[model samples]
Target: MAARPVSGAGAIRVGIGGWTFEPWRGTFYPDKWPHKRELEYASRQLTAIEVNGTYYSGFKPETFAGWAKVAPDDFVFALKASRFCTNRKVLADAGESIARFTGQGIVELGDKLGPILWQFMATKKFDAVDFAAFLKLLPASQDGVRLRHAVQVRHESFAVPEFVALCRDAGVAIVYAQSDDYPAIADISGDLVYARLETAVEDEPAGYSPVELDRWADAARVWAAGGQPDGLASVSDPAPVMPRDTFVFMISGAKVRNPAAAQALIARL
Candidate 1:
């Protein structure tokens, strides 16, 4: 019944974006693995997983609770905020949508819940006033469980000091997403660091070369110790010396080989 020591001394979790890809069934899961047991198998292998299902639809509290029961006690699940909350024309008008999304049984995950990812569309540009209002709408807690939030902005306009300061002041992390198509900003706005790696190539058996994985492992350690990984693009100064938790996920690119990439990173760590 006790919360699992996910970050015992300091928290660092390596994982894939989601668990339901059909391609992963035979390669990541056993060829004949029961569909019902996918979470059980995956959670045992990876410390954390990003739940993308919630982005498309609302799930019942029992569904969330069932997920908590299937995974190991040490495992963590990061839920993606629903499209109704993030995919809106006006950020300020999304208050009710955000409330409904957060209220829809997410608290049931309880101790197993890690971070809530709010991914904005690539077309959405920086609007300081509107963005600040939206950030303020993010609740500090839901059903008594404290919540950690990460914003994944896809546009290049977000690469600015104002956005960085806004996230820093609000205590929410601006996700460091790695992709040739998106702006790579590694700013340490909050104590927690969340990264999404999208550079995996299918030709590489591990999705990433050993050299790249080693570099990522080393970067994870640096972020865990409250420092910055040199040579990375940034908008803010390096984080102060203090302990922090880092959540890294291998996403997109070689989607089928994501699990392998996650495990490889964990092995290096």
Candidate 2:
């Protein structure tokens, strides 16, 4: 469970959506292992974790500090921005909510903080002007610690070139979601790559076939090196080649097998 070494210019981290799950009690965690130490065990097995709970509830500064203390030095926690920020009827008016969420002592995570994911509902359509305004609300740093942001748009309207241009101009990553339900935008808009792989199957021991795992591993390398992988859908031209840190999380589809899937992908990397 030691930190996995990275050899390239940009690091590629693979992980699951969150650390806590009742199904993982025996399958992922050692049988009868202390429930309180789940994050400690999970942090060592994977390089990152997308904190889904933060999307619904806020945590105290001490809670964030506690997480940072338990996690490994190289481990990262990608926070899902609160629902109040992205689920509003008018995204332009979310400044107060955004401020509230960012000001909630997230900086306590320190180096353990990764990207903040702003996810919109599928019903939310793309409004170039309004969306641009929302992106502007995202701060470059919080409490002297630099912050990275990524947006996950589920509507197909977001797959247009203008959307990609907006994110590119703001330097916010457009999460490359690999799923049949969401529009997969593979364009690289920022210096970092954030991906959520949602195609895991319950039948597969690793949640994905070995072939699929290999494919994702290859794609991760390509993304880390700042090159587009072959066959992914894109609305914009290829981005200039430059190294970028990559974060890939196994989420949704077969939730039970996600930890295994994340570990498998990490091994392949």
Candidate 3:
């Protein structure tokens, strides 16, 4: 099928972090296929989605292929860069695993491959040596020019200004998160701003609610109107990470609201 023309030229392309769970919230198919109807509904409603489930590893290619076939061409996939890559729990060589993981569902998404998320474990404390070593390994080979690589550090120490600057200089975005534990990285550079609002309620982690979607959409509007570095070059023509676009993601909370949260975001976007 031919790719469809995206309407409303200036509207932001919003996304949910992954999975839509309305159809099978409490009971999901473990062995067989998951919530196909729910996912299809989400795809039609939202511009894109980030596949957070793939972080577990061992996701089948056929499964990914099926999803690709269903979602629209304008749709995108921003995947969490696997536990083996981000989690301090998994100390195994991430360099090799990243290559393998992306080789499957991630890189194969071709143009569909969106942002590669690197969310550090919340409990892991900062170690300058470890952080620098990890940074060194990133730039060498993460993805092609089409993909946006981002890092989401969730730690008290990562709240430091220096660490945030380091990430900026490294050409990696310091993800702005809404959490009580850590202060967000101050926006010093305009390269690209990656903001994640985990819950609809300001003080809760209940995923994206209707009220949350309204606020989120307003933010996306602001983001598109105010072009950043990648969004604007030479101070004349303006663009987004994608031509004439802005990237905003509202994901589900830790309470498995990912699917539901995505559903809410898709409707507003």
Number of the top-ranking candidate, with lDDT as the measure:
2
lDDT (Cα, 0-100) at 151 in candidate 1: 96
Name every residue pair that clashes in candidate 1: none
Where in model 1 is the C-alpha error above 4 Å? 1-9
lDDT of each: 0.87, 0.91, 0.57
Question: lDDT per residue, candidate 1, 132-191, as tens digits?
Answer: 999999999998889999999999999988999999889998899999897888888777
Candidate 3 regions exceeding 4 Å error are 1-11, 20-34, 89-93, 139-145, 180-182, 186-191, 201-215, 225-245, 253-269
Worst 10 residues of 1 by lDDT: 1-10
Q: What's the true lDDT of residue 129 in model 1?
A: 97
lDDT of 1 at 191: 72
Between candidates 1 and 3, the one scoring higher on lDDT is 1
Per-residue C-alpha lDDT of model 3 across residues 89-183, encoded as one tens digit per residue: 43335667666766664555666666677778778777766676566566434345344567777666765556655565566655656555655
Q: Candidate 1: what lDDT?
A: 0.87
Listed per candidate, the RMSD to the true structure in angstroms reads 2.5, 1.5, 6.8
Candidate 1 local Cα displacement, residue 231, angstroms: 1.1
Model 3 clash pairs? 20-259, 21-259
Which parts of model 2 are misplaced by more than 4 Å?
Answer: 1-8
